[model samples]
Target: MPRARLHDVAEWTADGHRYRAELSAYLPRPALATGGPVLGTDVDLPSSWWADLREALAATAAVATTRTTVRQQWIDRHFTRLLGIPAPAIAWTTGHGDLHFANLTGPPLVICDWEGWGRIPVGFDAGLLHAYSLLRAGTAARIRRELAHVLDTPTGRAGELVALAQLLQVTARGGHPDLAPHLARHAERLTAMPVP
Candidate 1:
């Protein structure tokens, strides 16, 4: 499911020379799963799941550290730099910015929540989905496959970097109880991978 457009309007102000386009809001439908066992909310994810997540994280890190125009710099002058890569050119599409098991339900597994929807690089949503699936063992490959299928189109490939960017944001915000462990482990692995 993609993010729904709430409002879009263009405005002219000042002496008529200044113009602005404002896209108000967008979001997915409400969740049907409710309070029963939220997926991806566990801190101690399976090791196999971690392995698969590490692979994806490594790939994303490669792209982020290599291709981005914004270089990672320390908040204060530190001994390390956070490298950032540019998003690859691709067709833009509305997507459920946040996709997790908690947000899915029923037969088709409809995704909800559109607050994060916007123009992004390929595979952004799929990557997050794959990471969420990593909470359990034996699901990584399946999740990865599903992600690949969802993002296999040319437009998806071009937007892969956008997905990577979103992942990086999640990783950096280590306060989330559900994602803290995954992000910590991912950071370790990312630091270990050889920079291209």
Candidate 2:
């Protein structure tokens, strides 16, 4: 998988302000989406792209990381209220944490934006991509189909709900209003109960 390589980082105090800059290798391929993280329309991608994505995520999950993206306490505190169900025990794995369309590229799959990469619920990345694709039926279906191995298990379902709960919390803050209804509907399907 291709990715922008971080080369160096510098931080310094200039006058009364602090500044930081990072130098990274430029990636030539454009991201799969722009303007926002969610995909509003169906995108046409070849089967190979899907295969590559699956492989990439699998490889990422196999890595070990001490950084945490979704903590158990957060899930315990918010999951019941946000999901209308008790939080389940989650298995953890390394993931891209922010695996939406805007952070990925094609032709040859390249995952960008590594700042958020860390330990997360086992299916967090796949669930997040699936949630972002909810507005586009074709894309959503394709995600579910292509990532069924990870998205259709007990821990995976818990991870998906955790992902949806995170997005729903974001919606509460007036971000991605377009995704709220779809997310709520999907949450209902997952929990078999209306979200609070």
Candidate 3:
């Protein structure tokens, strides 16, 4: 829906912000997953798929952290409030809101579950996808390639922040033991990044 609405606007004016704000208002909040579902139980996607997913997450993170009213401190506060746990000292960005492998389908694979979609950091989706991809090995290069392609595009850079932010938010909230170790690693990677 965010993409669809974004595409609907042809002119660049203050109205665009109004439209985006309206879209954010209309969008529903995401439901808490009781237990994080199996990350890649449904999809037979290749490891290379993580590249595109990572790019998208990063793009979103960049937009949210840099462009939105929300700041990293605010994001941490909200995350702590929402998850009932002290927020990890990590950067935040806009998120896909609810990103899981199941949200993706079809050839060229479209992502669904836009309830959590909003401003985030560049690595949000990348971290989530990386955590999920941990069960497999030798696919990181492919994922990196796709991300490089995205970073080369204008929107790609913008979306990167949002994606990373979302990735951090979701992993913190989801509470999957299976993912804990992977999350820790990705979180470390995110924390090490030089703020863009």
lDDT agreement with native, every candidate? 0.43, 0.89, 0.45
Candidate 1 regions exceeding 4 Å error are 1-38, 41-87, 150-161, 177-196
In lDDT terms, how accurate is model 1?
A: 0.43
Task: For each of the candidates, give the backbone clash count.
Answer: 10, 0, 46
* Better structure of 1 and 2 per lDDT: 2
What ranking of all candidate models by lDDT puts the best one first? 2, 3, 1
Locate the minimum summed-lDDT window of 10 residues in model 2.
107-116
- Candidate 3 structure, TM-score to reference: 0.45
Q: Pairing residues by index, what is the TM-score of model 1?
A: 0.45
Question: In terms of TM-score, which candidate is strongest?
Answer: 2
RMSD of 2: 2.4
Compose the digit string of candidate 2's lDDT tens values, residues 66-127.
Answer: 98988889899999989888898899999989998899888778888887788999888899
Write one digit per residue (lDDT tens) for candidate 3, span 11-108: 33484463222232222423212234335333444555454555555555555333443356665545434333344444345666555444554334
RMSD of each: 10.6, 2.4, 10.0
Candidate 3, overall lDDT?
A: 0.45
